[model samples]
Target: MADYLGMLKGEQLVSLSENFDYVTATADFVGLKLFPAVKTDNMKLAIAQLTKGGKIPVMALVHALDTEARIGDRPNYETMNVELMLIKEKLNQGEAIRKLIRDTGMKETESEILKAVFNDANNLISRVLTRVEGM
Candidate 1:
């Protein structure tokens, strides 16, 4: 398996843990191009070095996107707000939620619930990102 370095918005850098096939699947699921570069022998060290000066990790950013999709209730969203805020700069929260819905292969009738989820996730992500940016 080959490891590749992926960058989002030029600031967020992710280390692809899988080979080409799995990387493609992950990128499609996340709706991000994730431009790949040369592989690093020690990704953790590379990430730490790259993110020096208080920068966040790419894995943490990916977790934020995943969190938005899994947040089912107000309490969950509230609890995970800090984690989500870290990746606000890396992705468009609304778009990421919508892409997740579209990628789920759901039927039209079920879209109502999906739309609601998308809206909720979008609102939560937007609010948290805004708050984090202002801080």
Candidate 2:
């Protein structure tokens, strides 16, 4: 929680943690050249919560004169997504949690504090994104 950094969604990257649906759901959710980080699965619950608060994903009207292309025997969008994910989403919060447990023993209200902080931060981020997108 120091100086801010940056993030994505698209299914170009898959984590063993997100094995619930098809491996390509993230990519399938968006078309092309939209939010480079277009994704919903990783934060599905968060977005849903914000939407319930009357927020929505930022959208655009893409207008192309010749938006036609031929499928070639080349790499697909998934490959690109994977590369983007490997480069972008590399933070391991799990390690942070482990260190907290080790250093503090996670005693007393620590567990509750951790849960509340994580949940609230996640929801707050979703709301912030929705608000920013609207602006």
Candidate 3:
């Protein structure tokens, strides 16, 4: 992400993680796309404590879009499709939660999580179902 963020001459770098929980959780918020080319709302931010990267529940907070101070080719940045991202989040989240329940030996209870995870995905998926499904 450091490259995408375009940081030159700095030790601080950014990298996107493979955890959908991060992205799925962000579906509930807002994100401002500084780049005009990208289309989406509710900026998503996923962060974890590097101090104990793999030892705790991941932490992420995204409430601002202030990058004016940073210098780079941000004016010509590319963005990801927020709609497709919904599919990734919903499917992956459902899988992960199920896996946790099955493998962690956690006592299972009423789980509305999957429903909630795919809550707003219907419209996003329906919009391109035919194309995606080859139907």
Colliding pairs, model 1: none
Mind giving the per-residue lDDT tens digits that candidate 3 earns over 76-119? Answer: 23343432333232233445655554565433522343233334
Candidate numbers sorted by TM-score from highest down: 2, 1, 3
Point out the worst 10-residue segment of candidate 2 by lDDT.
Answer: 1-10
lDDT of 2 by residue, 1-135 (tens): 211111112331233224433323333333222555455455222111222323344344565788754443422222112221222122344556555555765567564544533444445444444444454
lDDT of the candidates, in the order given: 0.35, 0.39, 0.36
lDDT of 1 by residue, 1-135 (tens): 001111111221221112124342333222223333344454232111222323433232235543564432221111111221133433333555445445663455344533443344445555544454455
Better candidate number, 2 or 3, judged by lDDT: 2
Kindly state the number of residue pairs that clash in model 1. Answer: 0
Q: For each candidate, what TM-score against the reference?
A: 0.21, 0.24, 0.18
Best by TM-score: 2
Which portions of model 3 miss their true places by more than 4 Å? 1-95, 103-109, 117-123, 126-135
